[model samples]
Target: MPRENSFSDSEGRSLTPDPEDEIHYEEPAAEAASPTYSIRTPWSPTGHTVPHPFSASRRSLHSRAPHPIPGWQNLTPKEKFRITVRRVMAMHRGASILTTGGRVGAEPGVDPRRASADALYSHISQDCVIEVVDYSAVRSSFGRMTNKEFVNFMGDKSASQREPWVKVRWINIGGMSWDVIKAVSIKYNLHPLALEDVFHGHKQNRSKADYYSRHLFLRILCHELGDPDYSPSGHSAAQGSTLTGEPRSMSPEPMRDEDRLNGVKGGDVDEEKTMYGTPPTSRQSTTKRRRNPLLPTNRRDVDGMPKASNSASNLARLLKREGDVKDARKERQVEEVSIEALKQGERVNVKVSPMFLFLFRDGTVISIHPEPDLDFTVPITQRLRSRDTVLRTSADPSLLVHALLDLIVDRSLQVIDEYHTKINKFERRILLKPKMRTVRELHILSGDLILHKRTLEPIKTLIYGLRRYDVDRCAALIDMSDPANANTKVVGFMSHKSKIYLADVFDHMEYILTSLDMFTSISENLIDYTFNLASYEMNEVMRRLTLATIIFLPLTLLTGYFGMNFEAMWSVQNNSDWLFWKIAIPLMIFIIPVFMYSDLTRVFHFIQKKMVTKQAVKQYKRA
Candidate 1:
C-alpha cells in the first residue's frame, strides 16, 4: 500500500497509488444519474431545501421538457411562438420593409456586424431556381440541385475548409434566392451589400463592378431576343420601354419590310355592327407598350446607387462601392401588369435581364441569370469542355470572364446585323416609294438601335474597370513593402494576359458602338429623305395643276366673247380667217415662256454662243 504522498514512476504505467486522490470516490453511474439542478436554493435558510420541478419529472436527466434555445427559457409560450414564426417567415419573404440586415425585429442585442438570417434564408422566394457547375483544368462536374441539396452542399464546403483541394468552381443561380445566396456567401465570403443588389428592389440592377475580400462582383444587363411567341407567367418586362429609355411605336411588323408595303395585314374581325352601327374596319392600333417601372434608372446597382461614371471615375468607384461585409434584404418588386399588356408583350422579342458574375481568386466564375437560357453560354462551355483550349490551358478565370463578355458582344453583333439588314431593305424600298408607315417602322427600328447602344455602353465601362484593376493589381503584387499590399494578393482576377485578350473585346465594343452610330445616322437620313422626296412630289403635282388652269382659263374667256347672244362678233359669223390660231399663237408664245423663264434664257444664250463659234471658225479659215 502507498502512503498519502508517494513517488510515481516515469514510465507508461505509474506504479503509485495515493489515498488523497478522490478521497470520497464517485462511480460513473452516479454521475450520469445526478440531478440536473441542485435540491437547494441559493438564498434559502441553512436547513431549508427545495427540489426543482423538472428534477421530479423523471429519473433520466435527458427526459426533461426543456426549451432548446437558451433565449427561449425566459420567454413565454406566445413570445417563443412569435419568434419562431418570425424566423420561418423571414425565410420565405423579404423584410416587409428594407433592412440593412441583422436579425430584424427580434433577438435583442444581436450583433449587426455578422451577416445573419435568424432563420437563415427565410426571405428566399420558394420558386427560385439554382444550378451549379464545378470544373478544373483536369476534370469537371455539373449538377442542378434543389435548394435543400444546394444548402447541404454549401454547408459541407463551409465545414470542410481543411480539404486539400484546388479547382475552379462555377456556380450559376438563375433566379433570386436568398438562401442560395446565403449559402454561397457563406461558402465564399461574399459582401452583404452586393448580395443586396442581387435582388435589389427587384429592379433591373445597373451595370457595375465592385471588389470585395474574396471576389470581384460584376452586374450587367443581358439583352436577349425573347421568343416571339413565348409568354412568361406573372409579369413581363417587354414593353415600349427600351434599354435606352425610349419607347418603341406599336407599328405592326416593324422588322418585316413586306408587311409595311402590303398595308395592315387583316386582323380586322367581322363583327355585327352594334354600338357605332358600322362594321369594325382595319385601323392602326396604338401599342400597349408603356414605360415599365421595372426599367430602373441606369445607375442604382445596389441600394439606390447613383449613375455609373466613365472609365476613370468608374474604376475609382469600384473601390468606393465595396460595402461593409454584413448587410440585408433582397428581390425586386413584381410590377402589377394588365392582361392586355401581357398579350402585347408576348411578341416583345427584345428582353433585357440582369446578369451577375463573381470571379474568385481560386479561378471560380459564378454566373447568375434570370433566364434559363443556358444556350447563351454555349461558346464558353464548349471551349471549356476541351482541356487544350486557351481558356482551360491558361487557368486564368479572366479568360472565362472575357469569353462571357465576348459572347454578349457577339450576340449583340448578331442583333445589330439583323437590324442592319432590315434597314438596308427598307432604305431601298423607301427610296422607290415612301410611305408614312415606312417612317413609323424606321422610327421603331431607331429606338431599338438606341436601346442596344445604351445597354452595351456599360460593358465598355466595365471593361475599362477590369483593365484598370489589372494594372493596379500588378502594381500591388510587385510592391511587398507596404502593409496595404497584404490584401493585393487576394485579388488578381484580371492578369496581364487577360487584359491583352480583353483589348480585342474592347475593340469589338468600339466597332459595335461605331456601327450603332452609323446606323443611327443612316436612319435619321432615311427619315429626312422620305420627307424631302414626298415634299418634292407634292410640289411637282401643284405646278402641273396651276399650268392646266392657266391654259384652260383663257380658252373659256375667248369662247364666251366669240359666241355672244347679240351675234355682233365678226369671228363667230364669217370673218374667222384663221384668226383664232393667229391670235392664240402669239399670246401663247408670250405666256408659255413666263413659266419657263430659265429654259427660255438658256436657249437664247445657247443660240448666241453657237453663232460666235461659227464666226470664229470662218475667220480662222480666211486667215
Candidate 2:
C-alpha cells in the first residue's frame, strides 16, 4: 500500500480533498479482473450517447448520520394540538379519557383559582351524583336537605325555625359532582387544592388526609365484605330518611325534611326533637334531668340501694325506681347479635373503593360515598337512630368521623382475613401439589396487596401528622407553613378530638401494612417453592429412567445376539429343533439379575463405604 499525500490550506491547516476535486484513474492491478470507471454512458434509442447520471467515483450523499430538523417551532398551533391529542389518546387506550381542565394534571403549587369552574364541573358530572344530610342537634330535628337548603342553613346564623340551636350538622353526599362539590366548597370555605382532590376519587384510589384552615379532608380506601356466606340476622330493612325520594323508616315521631320544607307545622318539628329523648315524657319533669337536686350530691344510688340523702321521700323514690327497673328487667329478653355483624356486612365480596370524608371544625361532616347505592356506614346510621348511642347523646361530629375511621379499618382487617384464608389455601396446595395456576393467583394477590399498601401508607402518614399536632391539646397545631407540607397545606379548622381518634386508625394501618408485607413474602416464597418442586420432580423422573436402563441393558444385548442370522453356531446349525432351546437360553439371561439381586445390594453397599473411606483419607491427608 502507498500513502496518499495530504492537502492543506494557505494557513497550513490540513483539509480533506473533495471527491470532485480529485482526478482518479484505475491502476493495472485494479483493471486485471474488474475495471473501474468514473462514469458509464449508455447509447440512446437514436444511437446517441447519453451522459451518466451518477459517477462511480463519487460517494453516496445519503448518509446514515442523524441531522437535526426544526420540529415543534415549525408546526402550527392547531397541528401541534392535534398531534398532542392523538398521542394522549394512544397512550390512554383503555383508560378513562379525562378532559384537560381545572388543574386535573397540574403540577404541584399551581394556583387552583386559575382553574375554571365549568371545566371542573364538566369533568365531575360524568360519573358523580350529589346527596346531602342535615340535622339540628339541639332541637334533635333531622331532615334530608338539598344543596341549596344545606348552604342556606350553614350560611345563615338566624335560620333557627327547626331548632333554637344547632350543635352539630352532617352533610352526607353520595357520589361526586363537580358543581355540587364546588358549591359545598364555597359554602364551607374549603381549601381549593383539597377541593380539587374531591373530584379525583376512584381514579387516584389514594388514601390521604389533608387539613385546611376550616376543615380536614380524609380519603379512606375500603374493601367490600370478606366472607362469601356471611349474613347479619335481623338486618334493618331501611335506613331512616336521610334523603328525599328514599324510604322513611323513622320511629313515627322523627321529623321529615318534606314537612320542614313545606312549612307543614312548627309543632311537628318540635315533636321530632322529643323523639331523640326529652326527659322521659310524663313520668319525668320537663325541667329535670336524670340527676335530682334533692339527692345527696356526694353519693349515688346503686344496685337498687337508696341514695344517702337522709330523707324518707328520697328513699321512697329510690324504692319505686327499683321496683320499676325490676318489672322492666322481668319483661326484657336478651337479644344477641354477633360482633361480626357490627364489623363485617352482608356484601363482603364487593370490590374495593375510596371514600372522601370532610370533617369541619364546626362539627359538620361531609362524606362523599363513591358507591351511591351502597352505604358502608350503615352501622353508624343504626347507632345514630338510637337515642342512647354516644353519637346522639354527645352531639359531637368528630365521633362520626371516628366511627367512620373505625369502619374503614375494620373493613381492611376483614379484607386481610380473606387474604389470609387464600394464602393458607395456596400454601396447602403448594405443599400437596404445586401448580402454575396457584402461583399465578398468588402473584395477582400480591399486586392487590401492593395497591392497598399504596392507599394505606399515605393515610398512615397523615394520621401521624395529625397526631403530632396533638389536636386535643389545642396548645399546638400542625404548622401548615412547614416545608414538609409543600404539596398540600394543613392549615385549617380541625377537630382536635377527631385527630386524637385518628391515632388509633394510624396504628391499625401500620398493622395492616405489616400483614401485607407478610403476605407478599409468602407469595414470593410460594413461587420459588413451586419451581423447586418442579425441579425435584424432574430429577426424580430422571433417576427412575436411569435405573431401569441399567437393569435391562444386558438383557437387551443378549436378545440382539441370539436374534442374529449368523448360521455358524455349531449346535444351532446341526439341529434345527434346537433353535427353540437356543432362544430360551438367551431369554434365560434375565435370570442372572434375579440371582444377583442380593449380591448387587451388597456390592453397592461395599462401593459406597469404599468411596466414603477414600474421601475421609483425602481429608485426613489435607489436614
Candidate 3:
C-alpha cells in the first residue's frame, strides 16, 4: 500500500494532498470508490458517456454542466438540402471549421462573438479545428437532466445558451412546407420578396444587390417534372364575357368545307318556324299507322302488298347511306388518335432547346436558351450537363448557382462575339454601298443609317454588362499597346500578340461609329449641296426668263404700234400687204434695242463685282 495524504474537513475526515509534497497514490477499494462525472463523446453514434475531465473529488473546480450540440428542427427539406450542400462545399473549399470548445467569455471590453459569421469562418479556417459534434448524444443528455440542474450546468455569461461562437453549419427539417419556410425566414431575417422569388417558377436571369451581406439571395431555372398537356382550360371561356368580337364556341374539330356548305344551306330556312315550334304536324298521329313497303324490306307494308322491286331499291339506298356514315365515323376516330399521339410526342427536345440562367447575388435574373449543342460527347450536352450532375450529387444550391454564373459569363462573352460579328457585317455593308450623291442616294444611306442606330442599343447593353461585370475581359479588349514595345515582361507577355482576334469586335465598333459619323456628315453636306444646286438652277431660270421677257418686250411694242389703227393706217393696210411689212420692219428695228439692253445688264453685273472687290480690299486693309 502507498502512503496517502489526508486532511480533516469540518463535516468529515477527507484525504487531501499537500501542495509541496509528492506522494504515491493507490487505487480505492471496492467498498470505497471515488465518485465520477460522465460526458457524452461528440463522435459517438450512440449516446455513450465517458468520464468527465475532472474526477468527483475535483468536481468543485468546474461549476458548469456540459451542453449538447445544436441541431436544426424547424427547417424545410429544400432548406436542409441547401444547408447540407453549403456545408460540404465550405468544407471542400476549406472555408469553414468545426469546433467543440465552449464559447469564450466576454472579456473586460470585448463583445462575445464579436466577428460576423463570415469573419468567424475565416478565423476557424486559419486554426483548422473543425469538430463534428454528436447531436444524438446531446439530445439524450437533455432528456435526462433537470431544468435547474441543466441551467447550473450551462455556466455563466460567455457560456450562455446563445453563445455566438458555437456556429452550426448544416441542419435538417422534416420536409419543405410553407410553415417551415416562414419559420426559416423569421430566424434568418430573409427578405419576403426573396422567399417569394424562390417559390415563383419564373426563369429570370441573374440579379444583383448593391452589397454583399449575410442575407444574399439568388434565383435559378431548373427542369421540373410536369404534365405535358397542362393548360389554362377555363381562360377562353372567361375571355368570352367582356368580348365585343364575334362569339364562338370552343370546338375540338375544325370546320370542314361540307360543314360550311351545310351551314349556308341551313341559313335559308325560315327561322320563325324553327324558333317557334315545328308548325303542329298536319297529319294525325296514330300508334297503329301502316309503314310503306317501297322504302325497304325492313320496312312494313302499308297495304298487305309485297312491292318487291321498290323495296329492293329502297334497301340499296339505305345500305349505301349506312356505309357512308360508318366511313365518316372511322375517319374521325383516326384523325383524333393521330392528333393525340402527335401532342404526346411534342416534348421539349433537349437537343434543340437552349436552357440557361444567369444568377446574381441579389435576386435580379436573366434566362436564355442558346442554340443546341453540336457535340457528340453527350446526348444532352447543352442542357447544362456539368452543373446538373454536380447539383444532383451534392444538392448544393450555391455550387449550382456558381456553375450557372460561370455559364452566364460564358454566354455573355458569346453574345458579345455575336454582336461584334453582326456589327462587322453591318459595317461592311456600309463600306460596300456607294457614297451619297443625290437625295435619292442619301435616302438609301439613311435607311442603312437607321438600321445601325437600331442595332446599337443591344450592343450598348452587352458592353455595359461586360464593363460592369467582366472587368478583366473588357480590360483585355482595350489593351491595344504593342507587345514588343512594352517595358515590363508581364505587360509584354500580355501584349505579345496584337488583339487581331478582337479586331473584328474593335474594327466593327470603330467602323460603326466612323460610318455613322461619315453618314451624318455626308447627309448634312448633301442637304447643303442640294440647296445650293436648287439655288443655282433657280438663278439660271431667272436669267432665261429675263432674256425671254426682254426679247418679247420689243415684239410686243411693235405689235402695239401696228394695232393702233388710225384712219391713215387703215387706208394704207387696205391699199397693200406692205402694211404688214411695216409692222415687221418696226419689230426688227426693236431687236437692236433688246441687244443693247442685254449688253447694259452685263455691264451692270461687272460694275457690281468691282464694287464688291473694292469693299473686300477696304476690309483687308482695315484688318
In terms of TM-score, which candidate is strongest?
1
Clashes of 1: 9
Mark the regions of model 2 whose C-alpha exceeds 4 Å error after superposition: 1-115, 119-123, 126-139, 146-164, 226-350, 392-394, 430-435, 469-500, 570-623
Sort the predicted structures by lDDT, highest score first: 1, 2, 3
Q: Report the Cα lDDT for residue 85, model 1.
A: 56
Can you write out model 1's per-residue Cα lDDT over 522-544, one digit (the tens) per residue? Answer: 98899999999889989999988
Task: Give the better candidate number (2 or 3) by lDDT.
Answer: 2
Worst 10-residue stretch by lDDT in candidate 1? 285-294
**Per-model CA lDDT versus the true structure:** 0.52, 0.50, 0.32
Count steric clashes of candidate 2: 8
Positional deviation of residue 492's Cα in model 2 after best superposition, in angstroms: 8.8
Cα lDDT, model 2, residue 284: 15
What does candidate 3's lDDT look like per residue over 1-623, in tens digits? Answer: 21121112223322122222211212223211101101112221233332211111111113343223234344446544644453333222221111111122201111111111112111110001111111111121112222222222222224323333222111112112222233233333444344333332122222332111233333322212223343111112122211111111110121222322232345342211211122212111100111101111123321223365443444454446556855987898589556534433222211111132322322222222221112221222232224334323343323333434344333334333433443444345444542233344444444434444443333434423332444343234343486753453221111112122223333344444555556556554655666676777799999888778766776677567766868777535665657666766777666756676767888999999999999999999999
Error of 2 at 202 (Å): 4.5
In lDDT terms, which candidate is top? 1
